[model samples]
Target: MGIAVNNINKKFGQFTALNNVSLDFPTGELTALLGPSGCGKTTLLRIIAGLEGQDSGQVLLDGEDASSRHVRERQVGFVFQHYALFKHMTVFENIAFGLRVKPRASRPSESVIREKVTELLELVQLDWLADRFPPQLSGGQRQRIALARALAVEPRVLLLDEPFGALDAKVRKELRRWLRRLHDELHVTSIFVTHDQEEALEVADQIVLMNKGNVEQTGSPQEVYEHPTSPFVYGFLGNVNLFHGRVHQGVLDTGGMRLDVPGHAEAEDVAGIGYVRPHDLDIERYAKGAEGIVVQLIRAHAIGPLAQLELARDDNAELIEAVISAERFKQLDLKEGETLVVRPRRLHVFVDQPSHHNQDAR
Candidate 1:
């Protein structure tokens, strides 16, 4: 079912947790409410699930107001970060809890509940562990059981809040794909909340980025990642080298380090800030008289696929990070406090003076 939240505002006394926010999620698609902690993603999700009421707005399910509905009546299956499985219940019992909780008139027969629980267990690839309790299961397995429990109700909408955040890095990555596949199989409209930018980009069909209780951008993952609508969105979504300067002849003079930015004619002589992605940065051999100096190497980590370098950029004394293959890092022989030439071909500039319309345009 599609969900439409109109001008939802929530507050806890003087703390306005959610401002005048409005969003519409279409049916059967994975929508992500993405933001850092305290950005109100969880509050919004709870409001949609009827766990908490909005001060001023309507929660509409398929164009019908559902604000007055209770959490149990909303038919929203919630998968929390902690899994939240009952320790004493076996996987089967946990998955069957919801069905058994309903009144006699609404509860299914014993055979029906068993069949449904078994089917869901198979769907989550956990039928083999059906007899095990939550403590006997691994973290990932427990989460799978929690998911199976949520699906037992066959909820119209699934709301997942950091469903895999508590797992190990490798397992979390695997479960992200698994969750996407499950979403495809179920075709249930799901809204997932996450603070991890890569997770949101990899999993969700559409993304809504919020900041300070306001909707900053809503688009496809690539659209929002590639073309961030504001400085906050650009900085928050990924590592970016930000330098405040002015544009001259369509090229930004970043404190004498020149960057060619096309289609920014009006920014000449106007103060602006430039952002360049870490992957877009090029290492200049020390002798080429490169634009940037490695003022500080904060840390270098071997994160499987790439060796990430955290360094201080000379221009504006801002910290910058770069990710390169092991082979590349070895060829460069980069060490702590070694000056390297870093150049960027593309540019993302923001007009500083304007309150709005600060975007990352190529």
Candidate 2:
């Protein structure tokens, strides 16, 4: 099922949670509402689920208005971060609860419920744990059971709010791949809320980046990451090395350093900032005469296939971060206190704007 929110507005006291937000979630595609906490991603999800009413605007499900529908009447399955499973019930019973609680006329027979629950358990690859209690299962197992319960009613739409947020890093990684495969097989229109960029980038077909109660940008992960519309989006999407500079003729001059800005060559000079990803920087051992910024390496951390380096500008002590492949690091034979020159291969220049500081993003 497709979901659409039109001109949605909501407020609490003097605080506005949603600012005339409008978006369309494509049919049979998984969309992610991604943003920092308190950005209204959760509020928007709740409104779509019919658990909270929007102050204005309409909620449409499958092209029909669903604003007046009750929570249970919406046919939306919701999975939460903490795995809100019933501790007192066995996994099988929990999955069967939704089917058994339907109105008498709609409720399935006992044998049918048993069959459906078994099918769901196998679908989630936990049929063996059907007899286990929620507390007896691992965190990952409990979350899978929660998902099974949500799917038991055969909802047309599924909503997951940080479904893997409660798990450790390793388990979260595992479940992310699992969820992506499950969605591909079912193709139920699904929307999940998450602040983790990697999760959204890895799992969702579409990404809606929200900020300050407004939708900032919407696109596939590659679109947003490769062609960010604003500085906020650039910084939020990945680690960026920001250069406070002024643009003149096609060059960005940051006091002691200057970099080429070919895209702005024909435009009038203006104060701007340059954003470059850490991996976009090319670092080399400093020589008597180097063309790029000279810096002294402060630290190097190599993990698996990549290495992260911390360096301070030789002239001003400005700290910079650079990411290079482990093989490159080995080629350079870099060590702390070694002087190096870094040239930014790609630079994105944006007109100077006040920074949007999110405690979580930093």
Give one digit per residue, the lDDT tens place, for model 1 in 223-340.
9998887888888888887767787556677674766666565564777788888787667556655465434555778657788888776654667777778778878777877766
Model 2's C-alpha root-mean-square deviation from the true structure amounts to 3.7
Give the Cα error of residue 54 in candidate 1, in Å: 0.5
- Pick out the ten consecutive residues of candidate 2 with the lowest summed lDDT: 353-362
lDDT of model 2 at residue 179? 96
Clashing pairs in 1: 284-341
Q: What are the models' TM-scores?
A: 0.91, 0.95
Screening candidate 2 with a backbone cut-off below 3 angstroms (N, C-alpha, C), the clashing residue pairs are none
Candidate 1 vs. true structure, TM-score: 0.91
lDDT of 2: 0.89
